[model samples]
Target: MGKFNRQLVNEIKKEKEQESAQLKLREKYEVPEDVMIVEKDNMIKFSVRIIATLIKITIGIIIFLLTVVGIVSLVFPETRNELIFQLSNTLMQLKKFLNI
Candidate 1:
């Protein structure tokens, strides 16, 4: 749809489904300790791994977005000047707020 490749879309969906299945299998079969004292260890491990991965993905996305913005700012003189002005104003406000 909308000039997009259907094959690539299907591939992405398949990959996503595979990852979901793997995560479910991990929860079903993972053993993280020797004693096996902790109840629901597999579920806990799954949850922790999911949360950590989500956080990592979010940070990576933020960095990537900032890099793209920086590149755009550097490529365009008008954008560069406007970004600098806004960034400086924001930084100054942050600095004053932080008493720094």
Candidate 2:
């Protein structure tokens, strides 16, 4: 039994040594290279797209605010009445110009 255990330990040690050698060979074959230019271009494009998206969102927000302001102004009684009066006057002028 002691001899059998010794043999088993020796076999395990041999297998471990073989695995370590293979790992060293693999590490020797693999080399690292620079990817800085690719990374920089990708970062710049990503930043540009982010800025463009932000600009579009800002424009959309501004247009939305203007629309809300226009609606609110039209909702007031005095402004509504004035707008209607102007529209009627314009329509009347158009009718006169067309001789209708």
Candidate 3:
């Protein structure tokens, strides 16, 4: 065959190869035209879980502190009055510092 004929044949073969590759890719990863795929919103789910966990931890800490205070007040009734007086004085000092 002539040089021009050989070049044309090669070009046609290359185009056909490219077309077949495209078809294979389309077949492998085909999405239906009418169907819609909704992806899972993992970020929202993760945020909700994190917030819930933090709330649970905070509640647990508050409960623990309250239990400790109750035990201490029960064990040391006399000291409780002193503790309250000190806390009130500390709060006053803090208020003065903040000028609030």
Residue lDDT tens for model 3, 2-77: 4578888999999898666666656666854444334356988989989999999999999999999878976897
Question: Tens-digit lDDT track for model 1 on 1-100?
Answer: 3787989999999989866666666676784433232234688899999999999999999999999999999899999999999999999999999999
Indicate the TM-score of model 1: 0.50
Off by over 4 Å in 1: 1-41, 94-100
Q: In each prediction, how many residue pairs overlap at the backbone (N, C-alpha, C within less than 3 A)?
A: 0, 0, 0
Cand. 3 TM to true fold: 0.40
**Of the candidates numbered 2 and 3, which has the greater lDDT value?**
3
lDDT of 1 at 54: 100
Tens digits of per-residue lDDT for model 2, 10-80: 99999898666666655666533321111135888899999999999999999999899679769998887
Ranking by lDDT: 1, 3, 2
Residue 75, candidate 1: alpha-carbon lDDT: 99
Each prediction's TM-score versus the true structure:
0.50, 0.38, 0.40
Best-fitting candidate, scored by lDDT: 1
Q: Give the lDDT of residue 16 in candidate 1.
A: 95
Residue 32 of model 2 has an lDDT of 38
**Steric clash pairs (candidate 1):** none
